[model samples]
Target: MENRLLQILVCPVCKGTLRHDREHQELICPADRLAFPVRDGVPVMLPGEARTLEQAPEQ
Candidate 1:
């Protein structure tokens, strides 16, 4: 999973590159301000399954 993620994963919405946030267990799309969840080692890439950054707690 980690191998595939780092090597080739892109945002479904914007087609932009994603950065894995291990602490959050998510793949964040900065341009789209969305976070795709990594569930049981598989990434849930659907937009509807994403969490919006606007609703996220500030770091």
Candidate 2:
């Protein structure tokens, strides 16, 4: 994701800052424990499309 885009993107649920997980291609909302996927360089910010931190693949 572009640095500018990442700077502006916020968690749809809590409106909190998101942390980009480059290795997993996800934008994570730590407060919500949700991971929004980034597919084809486009962020899928839908709550329904998010995965809970528990469901995140083990590092």
Candidate 3:
């Protein structure tokens, strides 16, 4: 993804900043613990489309 696009992208659930996971091609929302998929160069910001993050693994 382009730097310009990443700057304006935010988590739809928490309205928080997203971290780009280049390897996985997803946008990570820390506060909401969701990973929004970026398919075909477009971000899917819908909550239903997001993947739930396991909290225990990071701790």
Candidate 4:
């Protein structure tokens, strides 16, 4: 994602900053506990299209 685009993109629900997960190709909103996927270089920002995050395993 371009820096400019990423700067302007916010979580639709909380209007919070998004952290780019380059490996998974997603824009994550920790505040919302949701992950928006990037498909073919395009972010699918719709809430209905988002996936809830499962808790990561303890290390």
Candidate 5:
């Protein structure tokens, strides 16, 4: 993902800053517990299209 674009993109639902998960190609909204998918370098920011985050174990 481009740093410039990521810097300006926020969660559609919560209007919160997003954290990019480059490896998984996702933009995560921790406040909303959602993961927005990035496909072919384009972010899918639609709420209906987002996947709910499954809790990850603490490291």
Candidate 6:
């Protein structure tokens, strides 16, 4: 994801900053423990589209 976009993108649920998980191509909202998917270089910021952190398998 572009640094400029990353800087401006915030979790829709918590309005908190997100950490980029490059390997998973996801924007991780630590405050909400949700992972927003990034597909084709676009962030899917919708809350309904996000997956809970607990759902992700350990890497």
Per-model TM against the reference: 0.84, 0.93, 0.86, 0.87, 0.88, 0.91
- By summed lDDT, which 10 consecutive residues of candidate 1 come out lowest? 1-10
Q: In order, what lDDT does every prediction score?
A: 0.86, 0.94, 0.85, 0.88, 0.89, 0.90
**Residue-wise lDDT of candidate 3 within 1-59, one digit each (tens)?**
99999899889988899999887788899998898888899999999988877732221
Error of model 5, residue 40, in angstroms? 0.4
Between the candidate structures 3 and 4, which one is better when assessed by TM-score? 4
lDDT score, residue 48, model 3?
94
Ranking by lDDT: 2, 6, 5, 4, 1, 3
lDDT of 4 by residue, 1-59 (tens): 89899999999999999998887788899999988988898999999988888944222
Provide the global lDDT of candidate 5 against the true structure: 0.89
For model 2, the local distance difference test gives 0.94
Q: After superposition, how far is residue 28 of candidate 2 from its true place, in Å?
A: 0.4
| Clash list (residue pairs), candidate 5 | none
- Badly placed stretches (over 4 Å) of model 5 are 55-59
lDDT of 6 by residue, 1-59 (tens): 88999999899998999999999989999999999988899999999989999996345
Over 1-59, each residue of candidate 5 has an lDDT whose tens digit, in order, gives 89999999999999999999877788999999998889899999999988888855222
- Give every collision pair in model 2: none
Candidate 5 to truth, TM: 0.88
Best candidate per lDDT, number? 2
Better of 3 and 5 by TM-score: 5
Q: Give stretches of model 3 more than 4 Å off.
A: 55-59
Q: What TM-score does prediction 4 earn?
A: 0.87
